[model samples]
Target chain A: MRQPIAQGRTQKLDSKRHASAQEILDAAATAFSERGYAATSIDDVADVLGCTKGRIYHYFRTKGDLFIGIHLQALEWALEAVGPTAERADLGPEEKLREMVHRHAMHLMNRASYMGPAQYQIEMNLASEGRNKDEQMARILKMRRQFEAYYATVVEEGIAAGAFRGTDANILVKAVLGTINWMHVWFRPGGPQDSTVERERTAAELAEFAVRGVVA
Target chain B: MRQPIAQGRTQKLDSKRHASAQEILDAAATAFSERGYAATSIDDVADVLGCTKGRIYHYFRTKGDLFIGIHLQALEWALEAVGPTAERADLGPEEKLREMVHRHAMHLMNRASYMGPAQYQIEMNLASEGRNKDEQMARILKMRRQFEAYYATVVEEGIAAGAFRGTDANILVKAVLGTINWMHVWFRPGGPQDSTVERERTAAELAEFAVRGVVA
Candidate 1:
């Protein structure tokens, strides 16, 4: 009975540690997004986490490492949210595109803090005097290419299915993705309209425009 | 003779001061582009200018002010570069679009430092901070709307003249502009081909695509 109790306590401690790390990441994302990477400090993140800088150091070796980890995790979340919809073989290409747009926009609107930081770091911070700069950049570029390729595949399939035009798939993909990414820079959570309803409308309009451009 | 001499001296001093400010702005543009607004400091700008922080402060009030100035100046240059071509009444809509694309691409590629910072700041930083934030945003949105309105007008004219199909002009304008702005994010100067040549090809392709999409 004592052995079991000891094991349960260890499990609880592990869970607590995991939760702490997550809190730190959340805090870091907000700081990085608002103040930018260079201006934000470990202490700032720790303050938000209600912890000490040493706690952050225990989990993240360096600020650069933390930022890169944040970037990858954000991307992973985005992919998980949209990737499965894209992979549904039973859905038609148009439907897949629509679902992808809806999910992508919804994720961005709801998770703006997480998504916004990833964008700021990638667009503004990664190349600046960061640790493992080259490796980090390569990883980012690779992930971007993978994401683009995924979009291109969808466009290509749509074209083959007589739903999209035989236009250059690469350019079309870029246009669609660029419009979506640009949303992070401007999208607000709550203005006058419901965010979910507005996002759905925006996504639907964008998808329709894209389909029109690519469809024969 | 003394008056002329004094006037010349004053003129020379003013020119020298202007030259220094231009130099500092140029250096700051590069640093901001490579390091971003947050990671970069007045000292970094001064370092790039091969001067002291006092030199930077001599021309601009703060880093934020300097960044906003650079961003506005870059937009001014872009407007000057593409604005005339867009205003030409002799060219048809297709030709005008082609010219706008070529000039815009050339400007971005050649002035990547200034243009990149402006693009990044407009899309990300402005929304995140103070410093005439609302006014700057309104101005930017106005400029964008004007640009899109220009495209929409052309599309409307083309449709009226029976030169194009009846597509939603606003949506088409947004798609094209989104594609063009997206270039600033990913376009590199050169690889196996000259950047000028690539710009022309891209411009031509986009023009053709837009024309094909709308043309009757």
Candidate 2:
């Protein structure tokens, strides 16, 4: 009876399930960030969420799974942030790269507390235990490369058009990424003197600088 | 007889001790970066060094201490690379920053494998245990600031001299740092197609791009 009733509202139920999973990933990211990954346990993640371990287990099969989930979500967020700008046909290469980098900087700061999960993620994927885990890790690396490749392609376009300086697209993209990614080291949103306006301003300046680096 | 003999060889022994400490740090940094810090055991570090855990213990009191040692060394490397340029009174801000960033990129590439310990450190300092540990961590944080401040001061000078764009000195410094420090992510020296000439050329280009982002 309960199964059929739940199945009746499949769309709403699926959305609710998505929300629950997001909540767990956020809690786990915070815990893993505060305590080093090795020191953090699934029980601690449950404690933060004020739920039972079984509840978390229902969503994630293991701690490693939760770690991978957080990384995948970050990649998803990265794609979501850059996809529109990357796809917009009207935008020039410079404008596309600027908007893409600007959005990326903001996204990074929004998840600043999870800088570890966001920035330090790719390296730790192989150390975890689970089946098909290697494939998942490979996907994470693939998405990362693809994320970088978006910037590279735009940069290549800029270089070919003589809008960007003549440099390797790969190196330029890494430098731009380095410039924006460094924000996680200092630009915490709730930190001292941080405000929404301030974050926007910082992101703008970062994008400007990143673009300036590439422009002819 | 032993005490007098040891006293006679003090300076030579001290330099040898320094070399041994450096060897251990390099080995430990490699192990920590390859295996996540949580997954790396001190024994693994010994395995890399081809020595016993006792020898490692003779230098570092614990794994966290070894972690701190690597970070401190990285900071030391950063300072060593930038200090001469930062202090040279003859060079203006433009030259100073260019040379400084160029040197920094090379230094980062040299230790590219320690990107985890170099870039992902400071956050984990608070999670460790020991007497005066907080003081040591604070010093690490302090040295890190002092390093960034080197660039900040230079940028401030450039701003004052009408040489740099009118931006927050702190933000400019961070952007520059992000540009060079990012080499560790993808610029391994011994990796495929890597060469000393290529490293120097990349550093020069990176410095040029970083400085372009700052010039008025």
Candidate 3:
């Protein structure tokens, strides 16, 4: 966040403000999750951060912008979690899927805040329009398709290798991804029944279920 | 829609109007799925039905009531689909779970309109307040629990009979149900690549995967 000393204090302040975009996004994600995206506003996000709306606007132009940022971050996390497994040449399709599902389950379970808004991006897309809606939706979709394609590719490989039952790779991908994505909606941390370790065990079991679904 | 002749023509008209409640709910479900619950209104639902707002108002007291009614109806459909499988004494737990999941996936996929809104009841619950919110949410939660409890019972029975793997039954139930509930978001009928038979096969495969997850 440091600007060249010769440039002046004003530029340093601006850079510092820019660096706080993540903080704004984290606050916005929480607000959107607690209060549905349509009901939440810049004021609400600002209120949560103990800042003015202008502070939010410094980073995001609109509520849609914040939502898109949250989604992009979430997609990045999901891709980051599974991309390595998908790309590894040493792993077969079955192992690839197992690792991908395991990483994704952990990501979704651990980052519960971002998953809700990211999963509900369809509704968020509907709530905004004419303000880069086409570009934003297209980009989000591209990222989502990339994420889903990883699963589809692995499923196809599994089928070819005779490790998985032959089925429509696309639909099979959805079924497996759905189980992973739905983690945040139900799995709560520190519940009497759901200790931290129990959540980890459940994540492993979920991966097993998803992998087993396609595996012969 | 019949009324006694002695009650006159007015009574017949009232009965005819009363019978249209299901039509209103159906239209509302479609509108809600398309425009989302918060964006949809009585006028939107009526417009879809090619009727006036008065027609919708006569049947539903508010949009919340209509949303709740749609949720209840969807829940009823889901329960109806899986209830018989749960009750069958002839089938073992593994078979019961397989049949129940197969029936549920088909129900969710076939009733895509209702399932979208029903699965999104969390957002709907957030949108409305003070208008039977407690009663409606409680009833919805109760129905959902009953639905989940059915899965839990079968998982327990499966484990007891040494037919399935030992795991956290509650967590296993959530994982399976999440996959089933997520069907509507992605699966559609008669896509260029997806046929009716293909959809059925995917449903069966999902059941196979879910049942295999728990089975020893």
Candidate 4:
């Protein structure tokens, strides 16, 4: 006799599958960071997650899809981190920029598992063998431009108010954002300067240095 | 029967082989740039050079060797660019640091084919399945430290002389160098801002921005 499947049970199983997919993404990021995106295999990511290759393929059709997924997650978190500051009405342009940078730095250092490899998306784009390379890269680049526009908005406002030195807003954004982005390359968790206090100090230092570069 | 090889002819052949090897390295860098290091193959490099794979193998036993070779070339160029400025006793620390950053930015933008992949050495190390990972990475890191020391020495002297604001010389060095190191990602030779005059202006802008951040 066949038993009817319960709708409630199916929904529970769906949630569980979502959780497993998240785990796969996390494992993939770690493997990509350790083994380089090209060198890392689906089997390796499965091994890290203690799952089968079929399970990974269930969610991601290819390794490039998984890499892009991780990047999207990181970009979402980054935008989320700074979105509130960008929207705050009470803060001046400099304060908004300062808080935005501080939040982004903290988000990068804290969630570096995804953020580290996310910064390497350009490299991933170069190596992607996916059928959808152009479409995927265009989407990612669009998100990146939007992310950059946040800072550009602040810098333009700062210049208008005579708060920051007049410079090419585009170049200035790259210079400061480059400093923050480089954090993933040098700052390591559990390394010599990896304590909570040290991480906070570093975030502060980076924010101060970056903000000072543009202050009038 | 084959005639005995002439001594002068043998030497001339040796030099030609050396020149061919240099061409392979250049071609490899371009391939690595277009296709990330892991995705790039010796066959692709040989294709770019219109030569056979055996020719590349004659100079580089493995892709990792060729990758490291590009890195060494770029590092040598970078050190060469900054070394003269570092040694000029006539210039003050501020002037030396300014000139050093300017030259390095120019080198990065001009020789992006090599410098672009050189900065991606960290990614290469992750992807490298070569047996020489330890030795190659150690050599590269040693050279990187030496390259960084040029900027560090100038920053230290600037701080000591009260010419620049005091900050952690190491962290400050990373911040500014990160800005310059990031040029390869955004600057393109044939892009709208790729004119020689624009390249020079961008270099000056970056150097000015970096040095201004430290001025007391």
Task: Give interface RMSD, every candidate, in order.
Answer: 3.6, 1.8, 2.3, 2.0
Please provide, for model 3 over A31-122, each residue's C-alpha lDDT reduced to its tens digit, 9 standing for 90 to 100. Answer: 87767676677898899999999877656666676777888788888889898889899998888888889888888877777887788546
**Model 1 lDDT per residue over B1-216, tens place:** 112111121245567766777788889988887777777878888888788998777676656667766766676677777788878899887677667766776677778788777764555455556655566566666765665566777777777776655555654565556556666676656645656666677666555544554555
**Distance (Å) between predicted and true CA of A57, model 1?**
4.0
- Ranked by TM-score from best down, the candidates are 2, 4, 3, 1
Clashing pairs in 3: none
Q: Model 1: how far is A194 from its true place, Å?
A: 3.5
Each model's lDDT: 0.68, 0.78, 0.77, 0.78
Evaluate residue B60 in candidate 2 and report its C-alpha lDDT on the 0 to 100 scale. Answer: 66
Question: For each candidate, what TM-score against the reference?
Answer: 0.74, 0.90, 0.88, 0.90
Flag regions of model 1 displaced more than 4 Å. A1-13, A46-55, A91-95, A130-141, A157-167, B1-16, B41-58, B81-106, B122-177, B206-216
Candidate 3 chain B minimal-lDDT segment of 10 residues: B1-10
Tell me, by DockQ, which candidate is best. Answer: 2
TM-score of chain B of each: 0.78, 0.86, 0.86, 0.88
Give the local distance difference test score of model 4.
0.78
Shift in Å, residue A129, candidate 4: 1.9
Model 1 lDDT, residue A183, Cα: 65
TM-score computed on alpha carbons, candidate 4 = 0.90
TM-score of chain B of 1: 0.78
For model 2 the TM-score comes to 0.90
Q: Report residue B128 deviation for candidate 2 (angstroms).
A: 4.3
